[model samples]
Target: MTAVLSRGRSDAPVRSVPGRPAPRRRPTVAPTWFLLPALVVYALVVLYPSLAGSVLAFTDRSGFDPGEWVGLANFEKLLRDDAARAALTNTVAVAVVITVVQTTLGLLLALALNSAIRARNLMRTLFFAPMMLSPIIVGLLWQYIYTPGGPLDSTLEGLGLGFLTRSWLGSDGALWAIVASIIWHHVGIVMAIYLAGLQSIPPELTEAAQVDGAGAVRRFWYVTRPLLGQSTTIVIALTLTASFKLFDQMFVMTGGGPGVSTQTLSLVMYQQAFVYGEYGYGTAIALVLTMIVAAVVFVQLSITRRGEHQV
Candidate 1:
């Protein structure tokens, strides 16, 4: 009996059962099903519209009047048109100015807010509040401020600086006014993003730098800026995209006025396609705008990606 018991114990498995592997569970099909709704919606909403728009852009469709294929005639006209050329120039100028100015201001704001202060949270909220307003609403609000006898003019007059007041909504001043408003409105958003990035960084690194006799400027230049590579990339991309799509501010504040001085590609597209009756031409301009934005953004992304790897 003792020998039989010893043999049984010896033959036992070290772990659990030789009872057989759990029935190979069939692979779940949920992943495929999970993606089905979004794919279906995208096909209907985005893919179809994009394809149809591309096709429409090839023809000379004057509003509801459909015409035969004009090949690249619309694009040829777009290049030749002076209005389009001016709009393109204005758009580029606004984008470049806003990106640079807004980015610098945002970084400084972020750095300021990251420090300890009594009203830091309040200031953050106040700064961010403007960004939360709708662009159209903001534009409308600024129009009142920009119009003659508005608060801005009143303030100038009150300060005995009335000579500085100009027709902000008219002439080239309109463009500058819009740019200033945009910077003021959106700088907070960029600051918030950078603040988040700053918070994610380890405090010990900056503390260590301080111990090593690094001053504020030098420490930020050497340590903080390099580590903020991702944040900077995000700010640039967002500002670039926003500036390229500029419409609401120009539309409400100046109506692209002082005779097209503030006209942008997006505003031109809207006017051509809907206001006037040149759908095909508008589509061509739209295509060009899309290509320019995509190309520039792609180049920027590539450069940033390379820099990220180096960092």
Candidate 2:
């Protein structure tokens, strides 16, 4: 009986020793070969085309014949081109204005809807509904709204504010009109980002701040704002990039028009490449735009990441 009991005890699994951690199983890793198919497709589609197009930037190709290499001629011409310079200026201005105004308005809207209020859910849905619509649709809708004697002007005239009504898409205000429409279309996305950030924050933190004699403004400034650093970074990066590459809506509404008043870099590139068949010049412009976007985004990420760490 003693020998049988001892053998059974010896066969039992050993328990972990007190105060010692049990050994952890190594996680199973997928083989790198699993990514080979995707890598092959990406190289064929994206990498090959990008590399080929970039090479064309140095040549004087006109979409038909394989033209000779122009070295830095295209870039030099771009520097001296008045239209290109004006487009660059307008693009930068529009991007900055949209980023600032949209971000501010989105934050405000997020704050308002985040609070416990009647119809907040319905209001959020309504505001975000525009985002679901295609940009072309939004452009067409706003185009009609901005037309003289259209709904906007009619409403203003009915309200006895007829003096305020003018050609919204006129040269004097066409750029701004496009900017407003872009903001209205995209601000809801920014609001959604902020709302997600707000929800992630611990309610205890804000409650404690309130109990410690912090007013609404102070609490938001010190506690709530700092916690939203990540969301703000994401929102700004997205808005900045999107604004820089603005093409579709602007193309639909103004066609870079009222005499280039709202011409963006994208519009210029499109016109040069598709309309005029200046393939090489258009490719150069695209390369420059890509570099600008990459550099700006890098600096922005650095600054925002530093802010996050400080928070």
Candidate 3:
């Protein structure tokens, strides 16, 4: 017993072997500390500007000076103006179309890619390439495509479908065309998100359903869809927010032109502030837009959370 006790005491410490050094300990930064940089930047860039805009909404400040106090006047004008009303309606319609179309197409693509296919990695890269391009650049490229007698029209003519070709940017269909371009650029990201979700799902679940005599559609509906609740929430939320902030494509392609047809809230906000020099009114418009976006995100998240719990 005394010899065992002596041996235990001798081996108590982790002594390094001769000719070999101790293993190096990895250094890890605290999670809170990692967030410091982003928090500071957001405070300076987004938070401060938003607060200043809110305060300026009350006063009619035209960029240079703090002008007269006008309580609810800006909001009053915003409510009664026909242009503002039209802009709001267009904004809502475009957002809905973009959210639905983008999510559906993206989900389909994700499902297709998740299956065994030839050159799947190459296809993924090609699809995701457009998403990596600048929004402005995308707007610019689509501008040429939608231009009168441009590539789109040429392609239609070549296909003997010239009757379907028209001035996309110059007509009533301009907004939807812009939405299509946005979907093209962003649907890749949505697909990537869904692919991640599909990958995360356990193979055994699908296999079990198959063994139980469940058909393909039934298995997907009963097992896959419910499991993809979180991915659906993410795709919908991101696309909804992006739709509301619909500016770059509409701005570059149509310029809210042929009238106020394509004038989204963000586009109108820019025109009101920079083009017309109505800074206070523009700030007011921006504040309202921000609130609407925030409300949408909150409602979407809440609904999705409730659905997740129910599922």
Candidate 4:
């Protein structure tokens, strides 16, 4: 009987049925859906307005009626008019100065903040606090400081440095003053970004370099700077875009200055649209400004991508 049972068990084989099919692949939680709300908002608020502005740029919508098509007339006038040319020149100059100065100062501040120091948090808060305030508020506040015989000048005089003070918001120096205010306002933001990048770096790498006889500057240049490519990309792109789009400070500080010396493309666009009531021309200027920004971003992106490839 035992031999017969064993034979039967052997012949029966391991009749093991498979378990329930793996739970229907708990549907891949796509992150793309997270972007839906933002995409919708952008389409409605930004994309729609930008498209409408482009259309307006092609039409001379002067009165309450439907705008008449004017084709390239606005652009032609923008190029040919001397005032427009001056505005363009001033815009480029201001943007250049703001970008260069802001980026350099921001990097320096970031490096300083990264260094070990007592009261580091307090110093960081103080440096970055200006960024939290509105640009208009910053402008107004700085205006008081820049005014002749104002707090800054008074302080200079009190310190026996009266010769260093000037009419910061008048004449040719007004543009530089405006640029300085903007830099002070924005440097904090860039510094924060740089600080984040700096902190992300592995301390071991830096320590290893130090152990290998690399000095502070050498360690930063070889280890820290090279690793900071992404941070540099972000800072440069943000600074460039912000510089070109600057308006509030300019408006509040100089109102395009003694002779339109600080009239950025944004300020010119505003003046054309609201002040001069040249809606079509203003739209054209806006379109041009958008194109310039896009071009700059594209160039930066291209350079970043190429650098990535080489790496």
Candidate 5:
């Protein structure tokens, strides 16, 4: 009887307690398999072309011929190329300026608007309106504004500042003009990101800082900015990458002219591949650009992550 009772107890079904449900096993494999179709499409559309282009970087294909492989020759030429070097310098300058200015201004705008104020919503919308416009449209608009006798010059002249006006898109100032337009066009997005981060921060933090006799600046330095590390990381990474690859607005506004003063790596790559039929060289430039962006972003993220951990 004792052996039979022990056997019966061992074979008894487990039951959930009253008012509770049994735990269900999650189908992890099934959920992962569901991602296969999208992954397949991404591989075909993005990865394949990228890999093919990278391979072509070693060959002398000119879009018309099955050209021979000339490993590292194009890269060697790139090292000696003056225009490529100049474009690289300009690209770095533009990226750094845009990243620094955009991030700072965005944070300022977010802080200003985060406070209770009249028509804050409307002001936010107005500030972000430029981000909604296409790059081409913004380019055209700024192009018109920067035209010698267009609104900008006319306004300056009308304000007795005619001496301040010059060839906005034709002189040394052309690069700066392009940089300014890009900043205006994309700063709104930066503002929006910072604003979201600001909103997500708890009000209790600020109030506690105030109770501890912290002033506005101190509160921001200690309470707000630290909490915004993730947002800053995201914003800086995005602006840095986008600024490096900037092509459309610059193309439309200056065509990298009066010379190569405003030319960036992307513009150079485009001109080489499609305009000059140097496909191999173009791909090589593209590969260099990809590597630079990846390396910079990786370093930036690592630094930001380390800072977050320290905080």
Candidate 6:
């Protein structure tokens, strides 16, 4: 009987009586209110406008009252419009060219500036100074240089290269001229990014590679380049996004062109919305542009991330 009682006690689950006090509840966590203001502002300013604009893309709303539903007419018009097609192609081409050239030139400049030269600091300052200037200022400055009798023309003429002195911003050479301006204005930012990345690399790694009989090129290929993965990723992503959304320079410089040679998507959107009063079409273009920018950024990040994983 004692054994049976012992066994029962051992196997029995403990149960609280009905009058027993409930276990103390954990203190309720107060949600952080620090992000509230910024979140609210973002929702109001950015998110709401984006959503509203997307909705507007489907309507034939003017500045007047009573907007009518247009369905896919605006998009269909855009597809059939030769001017729109040309503008899109030009935008893509210019963006790609500028991004490639800027990235290369900036990386080269960063490498040069990283050398042990007495004038390195001065050179770095000069190189990065253009980035400090406003886009309008950059545009005006380039416009002057591209004028028929500007410094560039004079310099080329003086060097007996008169053939190279054609009107830089005129129809024949305007596209290349705009691209050149973009590269000049933005390369400094890229250089700074590369410089930062270079600074972050450990000197010991390079030294060790050198000590092991690796040549400069080999060491760079095996060490420096690999280490710069993060920086390259950042540069590419920023440059890609900036290139796709290029606007300010175009606005101030060519105003969509001598002949539509430099009419980017943003320029087109502006013309549609403000110039032609085609608000619906303009909003559709804006939405597509946003999607394109997102896609480019995503692809760049994905490629860089995969490379990083391999490293």
Task: State the lDDT of candidate 4 residue by residue for 197-289, as single tens digits.
Answer: 889888999999999999999998888887777887888888888877888988888888788777778888888888878899889988888
- Candidate 6, residue 227: how far the Cα is off, in Å: 1.0
**What tens-digit string does per-residue lDDT give for candidate 3 at 17-108?**
45567544334567779899999999999999778768877878786877999988998889987888899999999989989999999999
Question: Model 3 TM-score?
Answer: 0.86
The runs of at least 3 residues in candidate 1 whose Cα sits more than 4 Å from the true structure, single-residue gaps closed, are 1-33, 309-311
Candidate closest to the true structure, highest TM-score: 5
Which residue pairs show collisions in model 3?
none
- Candidate 3 ranges with C-alpha deviation above 4 Å: 1-41, 309-311
Model 1, poorest ten-residue lDDT window? 1-10
Which ranking of candidates, highest TM-score first? 5, 2, 1, 6, 3, 4
C-alpha lDDT score of every prediction, in listed order = 0.88, 0.90, 0.87, 0.82, 0.90, 0.83
lDDT of predicted model 3? 0.87
lDDT of 2 by residue, 155-272 (tens): 9999999999988988678999989999999999999999998888889989999999999999999998988899989999999999889999889998988888988899899999
lDDT of 6: 0.83
Residue 187: error of model 1 in Å? 1.3
Task: State residue 82's C-alpha deviation in candidate 2, in Å.
Answer: 0.6
Residue 288 in candidate 5, Cα distance off native in Å: 0.6
What tens digits encode model 6's per-residue C-alpha lDDT throughout 167-211? 677775688888898898889889999899889888998999999
Task: Decide which is better by lDDT, 1 or 4.
Answer: 1
The C-alpha RMSD of each candidate to the native structure, in angstroms, is 6.7, 6.0, 7.5, 8.1, 5.9, 8.0
Pairs that clash in candidate 2:
none
